[model samples]
Target: MTSQSISTDVYEQAAAWLERLDNGPLDKLSKRRFINWVDAHPTHKQMFESMLITWSSPTLERALADAKQTITLKDHLRCTPAIRWWQTAFICTALVIGVIAWQLTPNQPSAIVHQYATNTGEMRDIRLEDNSEVTMGSASDVYIKFSDRHRLVNLKKGAAYFDVTSNKQRPFEVKIGSASVVAVGTEFNIDRGQYFTDVVVHEGAVEVAGSRDDKPVLVKAGEQIRITGRTLGLVQSIDISRTVDWRSGWLELDNESLHYLVERLNRESAKHIRIDSPALNDIRVAGRFRLKDPGQALNLLAEVYGLKIEETAERYTITRLP
Candidate 1:
């Protein structure tokens, strides 16, 4: 191949990877594939770095800043009859560079904070400024802030799985109430309950600590820890599958209480579930159920426990069999 053709191929691949990075941090498999591609050829790495530097150039930043000051984005687009090829490319490159700049910049007056939330039966995947990926569960709320020294996420409600990108200079932390789980680069899931929080690590390790703890507990892969108020629970080995199943639209229950099951079901179901019989809340059950179809899950639960479910317009009430 001619040098020109080789350069074109490299540019195309680099642009594709940049687009993916813009969308969000890649999944584990995709990330591994990306690393392999970068390592396969020195030319590929050089081209990618060149593109990044070009996009983040001060000239482009000044141009964009001037355009923003003069007119709003929508107005600017409306005023332009047709965009040139280079202009279109610049716009796209600017977006990716903007994210990178936001992440890598030093201390400012304040960090840009982004908040994300999911409604009932809804899930969301978010890519942070630092290229960290967060998979939020139904009825979840998270606030993110990235600075030169730290990448912070506050889990206000529900559960989320975090796949953090490594940056030794800046550690990643998830804050739940007065407790925090810290990691340099790792995969972990945090579920915030009314009175407690659970942290499960699938890859690498994390330090878990509460406000009152003197030392943070190191929870490694396949291990789990729980924090309640100012206290941290003992670390224990757990099935990794339990943390991953939710991403595939399945909830794997392992001898969890009926109350806990119902709470999870409520997050994924429009028609809420309520345990009318107080005694049923303490009953233990275990099964893998489909989160997408909560009605079916409730039916299965009713069958397995020999209970009755009273259906209403707004909710399903679980009660003892008549």
Candidate 2:
């Protein structure tokens, strides 16, 4: 068959697949058949992906809804060849309009901004409009701005775990200072520290860019990267479970500095924690402690490291044992 004929046939098959997917999940046999069809030709996969993007567009949905008022979509799909041709033309027109509208908004700001935060000792689970989920850690803050082309999140303070839904047409990005993490469909945790931003990918992969001008580093699953200022650190292999232990109200440490431990503890502690002895800041400690009880956590640290804790009306000071 000629290229033009193959493309037209593939486009129709892609539309049919889109309809089937929209109805519901396919059975195992149907899934296998669909996979085989997708693998049969490169054009099949490309056409299906393009159709998926158009199928999920709000403009196409609106156009379909309007057409349903005059003629049922099911009838159009299953009926005469003329009806199918009309349906295809209508959907193509809607896609063209959507593309034009998107191009016209190159400089347009997002219409709405959504902000979410968690208080001291508080953790929150938030569901975004795109059906993505975010687990906000104690004293964490995030601002979400979604447009037709992109979904942007600014991590203002502390940490958050994102379970992003897959959408190739719109990229999901998390901004931390001058750095940003971009992903298509993945789960990852981001911790914004005082002087650095840490990213740990639990599933799939993400591209980490220290700045817009710098080349993006691909951090895959079972990997971690720290962005200090505008520089991207080495990508290191990590225990993903240990990094996300905070979701269970536990802080798991493995030879982390005392300064790092104290800084994390202060986020959930009602009374402030301060390191009085500068020498103690570099002390490496390891343990799993409950985030709900910062005092007990500190006491355990002191016991293990042979440190002293002085209590006042407001804060607890950690010093070297004298």
Candidate 3:
């Protein structure tokens, strides 16, 4: 099949998956199968992520299936070379809609800006005057600046989700580390790690840049872009549900590094969790683990990987089981 046909088919399948998920809870097997489907194609995950954001309203349920119910996506392709993006976002918007990052850069001129933070093992949600919403992950810190000129959120550490209300006149912007993501009206996620910054666009589009001199790259819905100390990295597809699963108090991993996973989990725990072996970073991990109970999550990790856990007065250490 042509690439256009393939894209349509993926959207159709993504709509079906979103419908299934909305109808009921997703079991482990189903979640695993879904992950495999996303892994099957890079764009597949991005498409799914986009759908997740578009379907945020109750009015949009089954919007995708209905869009092509009698008049299927394939039927439309018979006439047009490709479907329009607004139509795509509209159809996909009715698919995965549900509920809806960062750092500290300088605070530009503003009327009144504020700071928000989440404590260890805490998650907080904030609603801004512009109807924008922000969800901060554990131990995250951010600064907000709202001026007549622009909307800004500075993420110093941890992660956050920005569901920005549209205002073409005042574009929404996020600053994390040395990176900046700008959007007019959109929903996106940003993770400012110690080493790198990750940005995922669940809806709308984003422009990412390193600093003033660095050129910006556009990141559309269903796509993700990342960068470290350098300028913008390559934009890529992402699994939206997996990316923001923390919103539901769960962490979903797909062969993710144990060390990396520990680093995130550490933010939610009073005592830091450390890995003695760097090779542990290679261990493939999967499944949905809760973030509320770090102890339970760590215990499951130890059991799953057959690793020894040494709990000292000051630290929690993980090592290969003897």
Candidate 4:
């Protein structure tokens, strides 16, 4: 083969490799090798660049969509020639696009994608392009995708308060587990935890529906609703402003038990607090406490209930005094 042909083959291989890398973690040695290769020759770099752009072209994306449609049936995944051929074609197209996106992206210190995560007892505020804002709660990870047609956010895990900008033409939506919360203009909090998914509406209105085949229920201001994967229940009334009091460094514990309060505090603060006594679950506490300083709250808890607070490497425990 001529030198030109060899270079073309290398570029093709690079594109395929990049597409695969998009789906998984990159090995350090392989990444180093690719970097060195790109730096070695100008012609080789041009070839790689050309290949990347071609693969990510609109034409390639359309081809991939066509390929996806062909493999939609379960029977297609079985050992069959037709399915195998379609998969091969689809994978090839995807590689072409993947290479273009990866190679074209600037080589900066933040090479890999940076995912946003909120730690226990910490809340993070993120601003979106539409001038909307999201206040994420502890242990939350959210991915945002904005386009002309829609503003989408995937609440992969945890909870977040979304103060969305009103856009009647293109609605804003959040996907959590099997439920989706849609709003044209609203401020709401969506919680996805072990028990159930909760949507607390603070402003305007939001439509909550199951991701699968269920119809959505519309929730308005000062209302909250909980949905178990399949069931969408009634909307309960709430003190909208006070419900999200944590945003301003205050925890509104309205007849909440010491057990639940600890859970809320753990989520609101960067501390992992555990209640050692089961009896504390029945001890109801209602008050507004500033979340800025957890130490002061601990001191108050100790003084009120004569409880002992112990801190360990992994967690903090509160136990009743003997």
Candidate 5:
């Protein structure tokens, strides 16, 4: 290929990697591989770093900045439209980079594990090789293991809503902590929360197994289950639609702790929201907050709950009102 063609390819590849990182979580191995890709070519590093800096705040500029730079990315990554360079690159990157990442081997072993994750407050929708769909929530990591035997998606952290396309020969399973959720052509939401793994089935039934010694419990549609570590908890029925509201860009809280609510609200914004007093952490809050304006919601919370908010360019802190 010509020099221009090669340059285009490299720029495109770098943009695609940045896209994957933004669209979903970048696992440690993938992240390392990306760093290697950046290091191998100065152009790759420049494009990647520029795109990263454009989308994220100034804080990440240092992290994405290369030790020794070559070309300036202002010409390639950004356009005169005042468009966000990184956002465009991210959504478009997935269209390419298919052949580079995953290749099917005749003898697929469990060793071929692909890890994916998202940053704090970022949610992603990704499709698996088997056509299974995964919607990942913020601060989440997923390990995908597709072997000759079975297809597994391990929710290492946070939450994911799975829409499995049926394959009788290979059952779709999601591993959370020590528990495994098994399903066949089903739709369900699994949340790896701070204390427990919450499961809600929407379309089909799933067998939830916490431990090898424990019996696998069948949780059907409209049913919910919670487990922590390797221990099982009670199965209850819930409104599946109401629970997965975050997918639609709304956070519904009903007497939730102030600390927890603050965390969720923070995810919707670039600003870090902190509770000034530990005592305020346990204060219960109830409301339906829209993701469109998290700061507005925070202000409303402060006003209603008698909380004081302190703002800075870096972050926003919430303290009890005198």
Candidate 6:
């Protein structure tokens, strides 16, 4: 038969028949029928071979079978051409309905924007997509993106100490509030929220820029920048290692008040704690303690200064007895 005799509808019907017969053993009559169909036209043999190859290929067959049920029959037909008009008309309507249903269904959120959170008194170390490392503090969340042009990370809440790998071509940038810190091959801490943007540069240098300003300040080792609104100030000559001690599972309390220390402990301790006496709030506590055991730290605090520890339904309160 001539190519004109082989219509698109005919080819589609033959393809569908091949798909149906994909797994079954071919009988003598069935083989003869197939041969007769192929001989009907010059294009018929070519079309049958194409369909047979498609149905037999492991990759194509597996993909077709695993395809969502919501897919329209017309879509499947459209992807492959056929030789008959009547068969196309028969499958077109069902295919159209399937396409509509699939289109209307909501898709899940993209893997790129998925958010991960850490609870209070917890610290988690995560390796980012760009081969950088991050150790997040209590109640923190972060996301990463490694696009063609640039590498980026969004620290949604709380603080995190970052050991950024060097990528001079595409400098690493961290955003906290309206302030941001950009660096290349550096270690830094960003404590951010609505109230403040505190950046402590441990190694190398960070270019600090406020969202409203045209220029940024270069903060090097032993320096920290605290920004609130458009105002920025520097706290000079601070020990960088002390600031990053939390990564080693230690809370370094250097000339910090008991009230502030307790607050830090609440973030580092799994159990809730409280301060009962107002007088003890201003008392200074200095030293480093293992973050793994807040109870041991509390005991050390009580032993060093003859203090009393009490428990309530709400929290574990520490007081100074007269």
Assess every candidate by TM-score: 0.64, 0.65, 0.61, 0.58, 0.62, 0.54
- lDDT values, one for every candidate: 0.73, 0.74, 0.70, 0.65, 0.67, 0.61
Stretch of 10 with least lDDT, candidate 2: 97-106
Judged by lDDT relative to the true structure, which candidate is superior, 3 or 5? 3
Candidate 4 residue 88 Cα shift, in angstroms, is 10
The sequence of per-residue lDDT tens digits that candidate 6 reaches over residues 1-322 is: 6644445556655654554444443455554455456446656655554333212323223333332122234343443333232233223323322222111112412123224557887788888777788889887766554444445565656778889988888788775533567887899888654456678888888888764233788999888888774467865668765564556777777676787667666776767878887888878888887767777888888888688777665567798765
Indicate which candidate wins on lDDT: 2
Whole-model lDDT for model 5 versus the true structure? 0.67
Please give the range of 10 consecutive residues that has the lowest summed lDDT in model 4: 105-114
Off by over 4 Å in 5: 1-111, 241-244
The candidate scoring highest on TM-score is 2
Candidate ranking (TM-score, best to worst): 2, 1, 5, 3, 4, 6
Better of 1 and 4 by TM-score: 1
User: Which pairs of residues clash in candidate 2, taking residues 3 or more apart in a chain or in different chains?
Assistant: none
Question: In model 5, how large is the Cα lDDT of residue 161?
Answer: 91
Candidate 4 lDDT over 1-322, as tens digits, reads 9976676567555555445443343455554455455545665555555333222333445644543454444452555543454355455445543432122234412111123578876779888778999998876777565656667676766778999999999889886644689999889988775446778898999999864345788999999998876478888999764565556777776675686567656765555788887877668777766666665776687777677888777767888888
lDDT string for model 3 (189-271, tens) is 88877677878889989889875336789999989876776567888887765564567777887776776578788878888
User: Candidate 3: which pairs clash?
Assistant: 55-97, 56-97, 56-98, 101-160, 102-155, 103-154, 103-155, 103-156, 104-155, 104-156
User: Cα miss at 304, model 1 (Å)?
Assistant: 1.3
Candidate 3 structure, TM-score to reference:
0.61
